[model samples]
Target chain A: MTYHVHGVSASGNCYKVRLALEQLNLPHVWHEVDMMNGATRTDEFRKLNPNGKVPVLVIDEKTTLAESDAILCYLAEGTPLLPDDRLERAQALQWMFFEQYSHEPNVAVARFILQFLKQPGDPRLPDRIAGSYRALDVMEQHLATRTYFVGERYTVADIALYAYTHVAHEANVDLSRYPAIRAWIERVRSQPRHVEMPGVDQ
Target chain B: MTYHVHGVSASGNCYKVRLALEQLNLPHVWHEVDMMNGATRTDEFRKLNPNGKVPVLVIDEKTTLAESDAILCYLAEGTPLLPDDRLERAQALQWMFFEQYSHEPNVAVARFILQFLKQPGDPRLPDRIAGSYRALDVMEQHLATRTYFVGERYTVADIALYAYTHVAHEANVDLSRYPAIRAWIERVRSQPRHVEMPGVDQ
Candidate 1:
């Protein structure tokens, strides 16, 4: 059965699902949500995701899943995209949680403020940017010794973090200091069947 | 091998690890970190986690895992606490992600501000409390028809959310409005080997 994805194209979180689907060559249909026009906030969208967030994976008429990383785990379960070793799998989850808690709220939110909201002077920007750099510092240190986030192979953990890190410049978070991250970003881009994320309309 | 966990007992994120370890009957040692005293900021702690966060699960001298939810997944793997079915497993992860992203930041942070920092009037509290209710609303809606977060049974998803949710009062976020949530909290508590979270020294 084909999967139906409800998402905002320019969003890094949504892009993560698309990237995985393309890489896996999974049959799917994408329906873009007009997030800028209050589409996600509507009653109809709430049925797809009570959280009212983008990137909802509709497995069937009766089953739907929200949260991009969880969707990633769902799609990548039996593939090489997910590791088979128990400890390696947990390590992958470790980075994904780190991304959601530490990285995304800072980097992705900063990007939203600058790119979507167009509020460079937003008082929250300072802390968001500072937190973005701090998250980057941790990623850099971890990536310094490894090719991938876990077990030296491409996995959903990489997809989760790569979603935002690749577009961090939109967040106005500089990446010149993180050579390892730069190398890893290029490596992710070079993966088989890799697809580029659609840029946000400025 | 026994798991060595470095965490702060009073923190809900840390408490999640403790609760899972206890309920699963897993052999583990807990090392309480003095987060208020800048213990997590020290060089030694950084060696355990470069992110400088508590709830580090050290599997061996060479391996360590951070992020409480990831640790929970690790400890719960192959057990009833983690679902064996793929979709149910993904659903478990969905709620776990929601807890870290939507629930903990609001409920746990507000509790930290009030109980630990003693900042009842902190400006961030209002927004945090509001977000806490939003997260609770989602949980209450989900739990209104189900016995647990996933598969009608206790899982790490419940543990992940129950951490801050049970003590939301400390965050100054009232739970009286959420009957479903209140009922689910008791259900979770009734599970075998359940342990009470140690209250903060307020």
Candidate 2:
């Protein structure tokens, strides 16, 4: 069955679901919401996702799901994007949780503030900017000897991180020091059917 | 197999795993890591979990998993605590993600700031306090007629949220404003084999 995804174009979280759909070759409809315009706050949007966040996946008329990584897991089930091994799956989810907690809050926030809010000099940026580097360091170290985040294959774990991390430069994150992460990014981009984030003008 | 859980007893994220283990009747060993004293920063601890976060589940000599919700999912899989339905499962994870992102960042951070850091008046308090209310409002509205976060049964979703939310009062969160949430919290507490957060003096 075709899925219906509602999300803003530029959001890394939203782009995560989009990337999965592309990779999975799942036929779906996209309804773009301008999150910057407070679209998610509208009552109509809230009815779809009470969390009031973009990236809601309506799998059918009866089932709609939110949370980007959750959507990724749902879409990737029974596919190569999700590892079949139980431990590998948990490890993938571990990194996904890291993306949401340690990585996104800093990297994505900085990107949102600078790229969208256009407030490079905002007072709240310093910590976020610093955190972006710390998260990158963790990823660089983790990727030092591994080709992918989990089980040596491209998985949703990689996609979950790739979403915001690929755009982290907009948050003023310097990717130069992370040789391994840099190589991983190249590897991910080299994957067939890779989709670029919104506004990349691909 | 008995699991080895490395965690800080007072951590809501850590406790989420413990509560699930209790509910699922899993045999496990608890090794408390004193996070306030920089215990997680120890190189020894770092070896087990590079993220330097508590709640690492050592499922075997070669298999250890981190991330609280991820650990809960791993432990709860195939058990009644995890919904068997696909849509219901996604709904469970959606709320778990919300707990990690929206609810935990605010409510747990507030509790950590006050209970652990003993700084109730920290400048970060205002925004975190405000966010706690906003998250509570969403939960309250959603729980207006529901018994659980998803599928009308107690699941990992409730466990993930209950860890920090039940103690939101310690964060100065005015739970009285959300009667639905208050009742839901009580309902969760009534679950058989539920465990209390550390430092509850139980």
Candidate 3:
């Protein structure tokens, strides 16, 4: 049975799952969750995921998974996206955790506040921008000497961060200074079967 | 070679690795890092982990892993702390992510700001407490009818959240209302080979 992913493509958290599915060539159907409305907060959506967050991956009929990075780990298991080497696997997770704790909270949330929430003047914007740059600096330094986040090979670590990072410009996080990150973004885009977020890349 | 864990006992994120090590019966040594000072920002620590976060697990002196949840996953591999079933493993990770994304940033940060950072009157206190309570509400609802975070078994999911949750009171986010969470905390504490944060118990 094919997996059913419930989330909008605009969210990096959601886009990570979509990117993993495409890279792994997994069959899945997308069910968009209208965040602007109270769609995800409804009782039906709550039953699928108690947290009421988007990007819920429903496997078969009974099994369902929440948390985009965890879903990426699940989908990329045994595939080249998730490294088989023990240290490499842990390193991938290290970057994934960084993406969630450090990177996404800054870039992804800033993008949401800017693009989706349409609150450019929000007081929180300043801190988010600062946080985004801090996260980006870490990535830039790491990518300076490495091709991918974890190993030299492309993996879900790339997919997880790439979803929000490549579009951080919308959040006013200027990438002009991050030459390594810019080059890495181009490398990610050149990957096979790459998919773009809706309303982006035509 | 035994693993060398670097971080102080005061941090919940660091305590998570210590808990997993003791529970899994894995032999390891502990080296405390003075996070309150500038220890984490030193050149040596940065080499250990670029992000310079605590709970760095050095395996066999060659493979070092950072990120609390990721280290838990690494140490718990092939052990009962991580389920063998595919879906269960994903579910384990799902809660781990929730702990990091939803739980830790709220209460843990609040605890740091209030107890460690020592800024109880800080403007961010109210929001952190509110966010912590919101995350607790989700956990309370889920645990109302369940024994553990993922499935009925005690797993890394429990370890990840319990590290901060059991000590949330330090942040002034009272848990007197969350009876389910209170009960679950007792259950976790009663597990075999249960461990406590350093300096807390004799």
Candidate 2 residues lying further than 4 Å off, grouped into runs, are A200-202, B200-202
Residue B115 shift from truth in candidate 1, angstroms: 0.5
Task: Please give the CA lDDT of all the candidate structures.
Answer: 0.95, 0.88, 0.89
- Provide the lDDT at B47 for model 2: 85
Q: Report the error of model 3 at residue B95, Å.
A: 0.6
- Give me the displacement of residue A194 in model 1, in angstroms: 0.4
* Winner by DockQ between candidate 2 and candidate 1: 1
TM-score of chain A of each: 0.99, 0.97, 0.97
How close to the true structure is residue B103 of candidate 2, measured as C-alpha lDDT?
93
Docking class of 1: high
Model 1: how far residue A58 lies from native, Å:
0.3
Q: TM-scores for all candidates?
A: 0.99, 0.97, 0.95
Report the candidate with higher TM-score, 2 versus 3. Answer: 2
DockQ of each: 0.92, 0.74, 0.75
Error of 1 at B91 (Å): 0.2
Give me the candidate number with maximum DockQ.
1
**Candidate 3 wrong stretches, greater than 4 Å:** A200-202, B60-62, B199-202
Best prediction by lDDT: 1
